[model samples]
Target chain A: MFSEWELKRYKRQMMLFGDDGQERLKKAHIFIAGAGGLGSPISIYLAVAGVGTITIVDMDVVDQTNLNRQILHFDRDVGKKKTASAEEKLQALNPDITVNAIDVKIDESNAVKLVGKADGIVDAMDNYPTRYLLNDVAIAKEIPLFHGGIRGFYGQATTIIPGITPCLKCIFPKAPPKEVFPVVGVTPGIIGTIQANEVIKYLTGCGELLTNRLFIWDGMQAHAEELCVERNPACEACRGITTKTPARTKK
Target chain B: MTVKIRFFARFRELLGTDIVTEVVPGTMFTSLITTTARKNPAGYAAIFDEKGAFHEFVILMKNGKRIELTDAAKTPVVDGDEIAVFPPVAGG
Candidate 1:
């Protein structure tokens, strides 16, 4: 049910995915956990790609210091809420899709509700506690979680397909000590793009996702590599949880 | 036994990775990494605590499998094993 405008808006990309793929993107709803740094590129790309609904949550107002890496906000948006800024820009980018920008801080209590019935959750958060929360919700819902994080010139991304791939806790059991992490825009630009690319691929059922591997990008040396990762049998987060479909026995 | 050690993110920046080093056949995972990481004091400090144990957040993997910190001391490295050590970046 694409509008005449949508077919035209997504003309070039539709060539890559065909009309069916375009329809998948038009029907998918994605929940992004932040509107800063990584969230900026992730949401922008998803919005333009015509993901039917986007729910982005952020509690911080744009500050001058954020202009460096948080591309969603500009100098003019310095004093405005990040949600307001994000909503305005995303809607302007694609008038066809719906954008819901929530201004509440994501904690254990409201995280599940805020996420609602989205097809997938994108972790653009800056802290592990909240990321853990999102991970729980993703596992509970059996939805994929596209995870990305950046620091200085380095970034990492992994796609967690709930029951199929290793959960975030299985990969990194402990959170690195929190700090005012150093970052440059391109770091998130690279990682966030990878995340958005993951979302598009997931929604369209395209190429193999980044399952069972951790994609590491080191901008300093301009190198990218993936370390093969396995699920821990005793993983506290996903232990004993198998995919819904039972394996068929060989004849 | 020859083993390859790969460090990621800040640890990689400080230590430089893909280190192929020969260790005694019975070398434990912790000691092997400790010996290599010691080449750079800051890198060693980043991965180890004051008591020389792996920092709580440092993740260790051997042949694509997780090696819990509690078991790192007991886990032994075999020939041709690829070990990865990294700290997860907590930024957006």
Candidate 2:
């Protein structure tokens, strides 16, 4: 079903997953929750990988401070909306895919509506309150939530399969105090790509997902390790939900 | 008895990780961490409040199993235990 240009554009990666996998990527809708450090790499990679629809939401304007890690924007975009900058860059990355960038602060009132029918939600936000909101939406929708967070040279990522694995609240019940957190560009660049990788694996039903484990990255030491994570029976966000669908079997 | 305490992310930076120290047979998890973290006042302050109780947001694990903050004060540490304490990194 691919056009001549489409096949050629995806030729290299298609060799790994074949046309069927490419079709899944072409049909998947991924909702990314930020346009800052993590969002920049996540959306860019997913767009180039040909995810069918990418809905990225961000409400901030591009400040000079964001250029270090928000790769979607440039010097000229300092005053521009992050959504506008992100949409332009993502569309430019893959003319074949659809990129819908919405400029709004994601709150309870509109979180579910914004994520409509998406296959997965990528947690790229900087704060826990919004991340918690996305976790709720993912649990309600019964979709996978790929979570990633970074600070300075340290990063953490985990894939949440709603009813099957630990929800965000189960893993980190209390939100850490928020501040203007220190960060370097490569931190999110690493964690975000892991998140994007998780989305790809989930959509294509290939390889092992990061589920039930927390992947911790220490760029300072160039060491990576995973700690087993379990769902809390008393998790406030997903306690009542049961898995309606079996976990995806690897192809 | 000797137990190894591992700190991650910010805690790792404030208090060095892979800390091996001897503890009494009945040392509680909270007291062990309070003693280890005290090596650095800032690190101690980061993990505990002025009242010397663990910060609610800090995560503790013993032998890879989560130990609830409320239980940490009563949870005893034994020999060869690998304890991990960390703050959830909250940035993009």
Candidate 3:
């Protein structure tokens, strides 16, 4: 039963997209990796937007450090699993939707199957190995992937539409040695919001996407730009690689 | 010849923008940046650190091929090339 108040509350967005947009929202399922900095905003935005279903995958436990930007949890929620805390917050925010909080880390073994289950995925995980796995599986399976990353005063995003756009591997074959680069949590919030925007735009079949174009934002100088990138015909993850789609993981 | 420019992750932040262009002769990839940076200080500062070498995490590419910063000065740019700069990417 759609309520008048709910309709009024969502009128602006509904007006922009119409009943068809609402239907797509009702049909969409989003898989978000990580419940850390980026995941917090991604979760909140998707849930509030009335996405029909969301599966949040993360294994970390909340700590004091995350409170600065992990808006899904609070001081009292510390020591709770991140996926659980985020799930609780998201469900509380939108009782109209389903939030599946999976408390687990994504790995090669489970990457393909887990990703295949969703309509699209938001790359919110904060490391390289998992990023590669996400890129590889997403490409092999021909799924849309929204990628966002933030550190210090900078952040970037790109939309990978499987074979249509470049995968993360074509751009970066290997990850640099991980480091605790200086970061302010809100940076992730900014980028994560854009990631959510891309997800929404992709789901609703809205305007032209960031496909093949990278959106970069810098907080220091308050400047942003979009650069064009093309697919590499020989990309190991896309064209010339012999790889198996990792089967869906044990539920 | 013309070369396309790209920025990713942190490099995009420090530079404050994404794409740039240059219509220079086949100069070294590094020189093309210096030429482009002449008009955009943020782009210059974004790529070359205090020592003028790309920061350790920075990755440079020529027409989609990865190029070591040490050789950026010698990597000749050809027509229709795309040069990319990215901070260490961290995401899944």
Best by the lDDT measure? 2
Model 3 chain A worst lDDT run, 10 consecutive residues: A242-251
Taking the tens digit of each residue's C-alpha lDDT, what string does model 1 give over A169-227?
A: 98888888889988999999999999999999989877888989999999999999998
Winning model by TM-score: 2
Lowest summed-lDDT stretch of 10 residues in model 1 chain A?
A242-251
* Pairs in steric clash, model 3: A113-A248
Q: Write the per-residue lDDT of candidate 2 for residues A50-135, one digit (tens) a residue.
A: 99999999999999999998899999999999999999999988999999999999999999999999988999999999999999
Pairs in clash, predicted candidate 2: none
- Per-model tally of clashing residue pairs: 0, 0, 1
**Candidate order by lDDT, highest to lowest?**
2, 1, 3
- List TM-scores for all candidates, in order: 0.95, 0.98, 0.79
lDDT of 3 by residue, B1-92 (tens): 56677655654544434455657676888777666555656767756666677655567777656686678888888888777777755632
User: Model-by-model lDDT, in order?
Assistant: 0.92, 0.93, 0.76
Query: Model 3: per-residue lDDT, tens digit, A10-128?
Result: 67899889877777876788889889888999989999998889999998999998887788889999999987798889988988889999987799888777765688889997887
RMSD for all candidates, in order, please.
3.0, 1.3, 6.0
Evaluated at residue B50, the lDDT of candidate 1 is 97
Counting only residues 3 or more apart in sequence or on different chains, how many pairs clash (N, Cα, C under 3 Å) in candidate 3? 1
Q: Model 3 off-target regions past 4 Å? A: A1-6, A240-251, B1-27, B30-57, B61-74, B77-84
Error of 2 at B9 (Å): 0.5
Kept native contacts, as fractions per model, are 0.91, 0.88, 0.36
